[model samples]
Target chain A: MTNKLLYLSQADVKSVGLTMAEIIEATEKGFMEMGNNRVEMPPKPGIHPGEGGDNFIHAMPAFIPAMDAAGVKWVSGYPGNQQKGLPYINGLLILNDPETGLPLSVMDCSWITAMRTAAASAVSAKYLARPESSTIGILACGVQGHTNLEAMNVLFPLKKVMAYDPSPENAEKLARFGKETLGLEVTIVSDPKDAVTGCDIVVTSGPILKVPHATIQAGWLNEGTFVSCVDFDSFFSREALKEAAKWTTDNLDQYNHYKDKVGFFVDCPGVYAELGELVTGKKKGRENATEKNFAANLGLAMEDMAVAPLIYKKAAEKNIGTWLTL
Target chain B: MTNKLLYLSQADVKSVGLTMAEIIEATEKGFMEMGNNRVEMPPKPGIHPGEGGDNFIHAMPAFIPAMDAAGVKWVSGYPGNQQKGLPYINGLLILNDPETGLPLSVMDCSWITAMRTAAASAVSAKYLARPESSTIGILACGVQGHTNLEAMNVLFPLKKVMAYDPSPENAEKLARFGKETLGLEVTIVSDPKDAVTGCDIVVTSGPILKVPHATIQAGWLNEGTFVSCVDFDSFFSREALKEAAKWTTDNLDQYNHYKDKVGFFVDCPGVYAELGELVTGKKKGRENATEKNFAANLGLAMEDMAVAPLIYKKAAEKNIGTWLTL
Candidate 1:
């Protein structure tokens, strides 16, 4: 008769420190489960029945079918959030009983975003990125950029990391941050190509309302390299994506929705073969680590979907916040 | 920057002891605002294209375009809920500022539900039930049954109350309980006709798994008597509802969803009106004291919509729960 309501605060969540490494790892695990077809990844575009609002509020919920736990997360994006000092991406993740209706926990979703998006990139790298890849190129120094590197390092043994960001402070901040925190060799490059050259993994987390090119110089792309992105605009050419040996997304319906909103990124490697499909083995991962591939890391609901259960468990174990009794 | 999560026990809500009279008055205000088209009731059924369940989760949100707050109450009906002990209807009424996304409160929906459903019913009786209605016939003497009497008594001058239940002891217990607590005439009738005869109103708050019908001898329905139902059964003939001078519901879309689920129990009255629509001169209420009318109280999102605000205001004023630094 009791409702299991667990509350976790930013401080509580921080004290527990859902680490950058942890998010990357969980995301990889998420993809592993998804690829095995044990994770539920429903479509991501939501109700647009209302008028005049540019952002879409999507409902992403995932239950690792084998794990017996599920979480439903609501992610709302309105580009206008910046003018108001709110993070452009904002959401809540509620972990609940998969069997009963009790709400087990509620957590801030900023971290959920980092892990899922990066996990998606990691899945692409595991399957499509070159095995001998020694360097990685990054396009931004924000949160997604931070996690993307962690995911790459875990899934691939990269020797060098380089980035291009207009903000000196961001570049400097992440320069020291990545080295000290992630233990990666880092450098700040002056131009996109300065960072793009000779790299086997090209990762782009963009400030893309303003962007470089969607299509990179084909000559610049080393054979058997991989390109991963959170923004399709960062790599504008569908042709660039088409050239890769393989294409993938966290979920295909989501990729299609994104295509509808932002236009073609590439003929997506058929949407069903998305990360979850790959996990489920409906499709195979990299024929070899040397396969050239492109994965659009559009952040699957399955990421928050899978992570929701983790947050609920941790918060409950700690008796984190005030319980709501009804 | 802060989330005020509050919990109230069912006992605490009962302690609020807001009578059907007070709630009736509050709903009058709610109706005035709703009638002005201030209440935003949007189409709730959105099927997730790739979702695997037979049930759909709907979101019903409203902004009293002129009020201090807004909320999107997510009412997810998976139907799998019934196999578990959970109540079929479950959701959170999130209260937030209209100008800012600051959440003022989060409260249990059960209280909001019990009160608002009763309030809407009371408002219906105020406008549609017979004047000097001395007695009422109650079918399905459960939660809905108990509250309908509480609300009806507040809006009418009832001299007696009678009920028929499949479980005779349950009927006897409820009757004894009502007589002791409600303090007026109450009885457990042996026959459905006995419960209905000589009563000015017949109330049906049914949650029957299948359709239920009550065959009425002509005299069992006194002249100028009214029928109110929370059920979608073939309890009364189509001729009965067709002959009603007025036919109404709290929200039209909700009734339509119900209509789709349970085919018409009555003929479509040539006159169809919303309770709030009538308040705004979009339609009219009862025109004659003797008019036999039917009010189908399917309930609305806007009713529980006020709970978070009400709880926020009350909890803030009374310093009811502990606060957390998140």
Candidate 2:
């Protein structure tokens, strides 16, 4: 029997034209599967290859039987790469044929990581944020800052973006993209507090750190602000996290796994629900307009599994990817 | 910057013409790095996607800084595939540039898995087996049975083979290959005991089980015998395993991780040393002629990381694989 699979490059993946709404829908379906206990997702296993155990290459695998998606994302994060003029994250996603366990496609994971991660935040915000939420605070204005704005724009009628980064150049780049591509009023902020203070939604998008040098203070966040932490407590202080009335994460097992190793969720509020539970209506999301809502959506493998099949199917239909024998 | 990587199919990987000795050397070097605490290899994490949770797709990642190799082997084992006229194992090995943490190449892992696993057994035998060992007993005469004979032939002056399999046809196939390819006297044993008894070297290559139905008993092995178990404890009974003078495995953390989950090493002899310790001269292997040494080399990701860089380098030099933009 011949073993052949499609290869989708970053350009090819982008050419597939998967909208943020579509990715959010797929991501929500994946969370529903997780909520219903129909998905098999192991806590991501990673290896730190760089000095000081800061840079990591993680293997994230998940099987969503409901979507017939089974695969792994081999992704790496090198904080030093920013100085080396390379992307901080780089890797590939391998999608498999669930029946015979053969690879069906190998695609660039950078785009998927950017989109699905933002979509996960959007999904969390869908349940946790008010429908009329307009302003968004974006910390660490890099790839995720741009993608998060695009995704949040798809969900809420956003009017302005408050962006901050250690590098003013990065914040400016995101502001340019926000103004040109997203057509939103973008304000480059000087401080993290300025970003978080009166925003309807806040997204922390910095690099995930083992020991966070947190800067977001407890009272900086406005009441009823929906906070989506993609950076794993890197920007949010323990006191800041405690201000949330409802605390939820994408996956509790994964959060606890990293929490044990990295000491991230220590002395925080007890987790009110997993994002999936809210998706499945098994637990409440935002109860009152005055209550603070926080969701730490650590990017899950099932989110990639959910969106990857769509990319593969559409790419195959469009004949946009290269096919090679295995 | 262009992100391009060579894609080597099974044919391309085979065309590299890597010898069993070369593979063994690479695998041994990987073990030496592990012994010196220079390699980063997390315990392989897997997900069972099939019915009854019997079938598994595992993500094995390792970083061998000494070899400048960092990558992952995304592999799957579906026993049901054999009945459907497909190979029981299939997947890909992704090699990465250690400095930048970007993928360098993608290659078929089936050949690597088969060859590297057998090379691990041969590396174990290099330390544990007597140099004058001639006869080898092989249980489960499938692909591993063929590869194990090839690897052992590279190390020892082997003259005869005793092969056993549940399927008579598989045993016959291996027997024919042994006679035709290696010019060794082949015997098809009717029972597993017949295969193990009186053999200087024994290799058990079967399916790894969560709950093993072991068959090999305590008295079957001979004095001065070297045993390599690639199939976990599926073939060797607890009493049989206890017969070994010293017990060793590829990695203790991995062994204990699986042991906690699958109950494989429970009540067995304590592992005296990892195979790397023996390779690095930190631990003795076969101390005397009458000693029985056993190594349960549950295949390490560093083995693939060590070998894959060689394949990628050679494939690039030979221009043998397709280069795809990522």
Candidate 3:
């Protein structure tokens, strides 16, 4: 009968001390649920603001019955915010009690979004990437670059990281984190092709754009490399996508939804399978070591649902957040 | 660059003291914006929980550029909650700074939803109903019934109310409010037809159902009667809906979206115009005195966006809410 719900700030969410491995495991479980047809997720409904119509606020809602998680994540991504010294993405996540449909917790979505997105890519790479993959090429060395590096390091025996960013300062910052915090050899590549040609796994984490200014060329990627595109075709050219032996996505319905409306995937290679299908063994993953693999993992609300409840429980146990009454 | 947002509970929202007249005016402005193509409102995306799939949580987001309003209302409706001594609908509205896309306030959505929904109905009737409207009939004697009565009282003169509910206690409650608060002649009608037969304005506030158990039949409505359906075709039969000379809705796209997916309004009359068109004078309302006009106002997020910012400003000026840092 209590109407109090826990509220966690961005700092409080980080204080919960969730590991990259834990987030990857949770995100994989969500995809497994999806593969088994146990979750409900509608393609995100969004509104574009500003004159250029590039900034967006999306309402993503999902329900995973097996996880007992049901809620909505109201998040915004304003590429213009970076010029104002604000984060590019910010929002909140509301987790509801499955039985009564009452909000149980409200938490900052930035931290969860940052970690879960990289975790999804990590989950995809685990099934698609070569087992002996030791080098990673990361584009756009922002929050996603750092988190994706951390996540990939958890699954692969990464020996060195090649980072590329339009801003040398951002690339240097990520390089420092990779060398000091993760204890890996890091290289800052001036050309985007230098970052992609020799690496065994490549991750493109640039902003999703309505009109892509893609730089990665068709023949740039090494043979047997696995490519994870967190950004929606903004970093990879159409020819580059077609060069892959098999291209998969996190969710086929969501990819098709955005492709039709936003005009992202135009005349590109057809998706071979959803990541969930690969996770549940419903489809094959990296059948041969020499076959190039690619996955465009547009984030899903179910991934947030998968990770948020765990954070809420941990924060409650540690007494780390404020409880506000409704 | 402040990351703090005002949080108002339900009591704090009530303390702001927004009148029905103000709410009606604001809702009218929202409709005008819709008609003028100045607002961005996507069809609501929802998730149905529970085994029976009757419980729902919907994310309604809108941006009204002229009003400088942008936000999302996360609301849930569980009919089973009534038996558990909980309100059937509970939610929170988060208003964001349109310039920076940072949240400015978070407030309870129940009060705003109730008031704005009725205000929309009243606005519809203002254009569609006879100018000398006196008697009003309300179908469900719940929160919407009382609010609808209050809204109708603001726009009409010297009225009587015919209240109908399956439960006599609820009807009695609404009857008491009509007589004591509004000082109107009130009657509790046992038959649904009695509530609709002689009224100038009829309001149906029943629960929105996937499979509607319609009771009101064709020929039940009187000539020159204006019908407002807050619920989705749950009270009025298809024949009753077809009986209207002119049929309109709050938003045509939303109505069609739901109609295709939820199987409501199957084989019903085609809509003549949106309520926004009527508000903006693009379409006629009631051209003749003998015409029966009907409008189904499936509540819009733009309506909430219209009312919520006003409450936030008032509550801030009064220092009536908690400021929580993000």
| Chain A TM-score, cand. 1 | 0.86
Model 3 off-target regions past 4 Å? A209-214, A237-243, B191-194, B209-214, B217-220, B237-243, B266-268
Model 3 lDDT per residue over B266-315, tens place: 77779999989999999998999999998888889999999999999999
Name every residue pair that clashes in candidate 3.
none
lDDT of 1 by residue, B102-127 (tens): 33454556666766787787777777
List interface RMSDs for the candidates, in order: 5.5, 0.9, 0.9
DockQ of each: 0.23, 0.75, 0.67
True contacts kept of 3: 0.56
User: Which stretch of 10 consecutive residues in model 1 chain B shows the poorest summed lDDT?
Assistant: B43-52
Off by over 4 Å in 2: A164-168, A187-198, A207-220, A236-242, A265-267, B166-168, B189-194, B207-220, B236-242, B257-260, B265-267
Using DockQ as the yardstick, the better of models 2 and 3 is 2
Q: lDDT scores for all predictions? A: 0.64, 0.90, 0.90
Give the lDDT of residue B306 in candidate 1: 47
Q: Report the lDDT tens digits of candidate 1 across residue range A213-235.
A: 55455456666778886776455
Name the docking class for model 3.
Answer: medium
Model 3 residue A182 CA deviation in Å: 1.1
Score residue A64 of candidate 1 by CA lDDT.
65
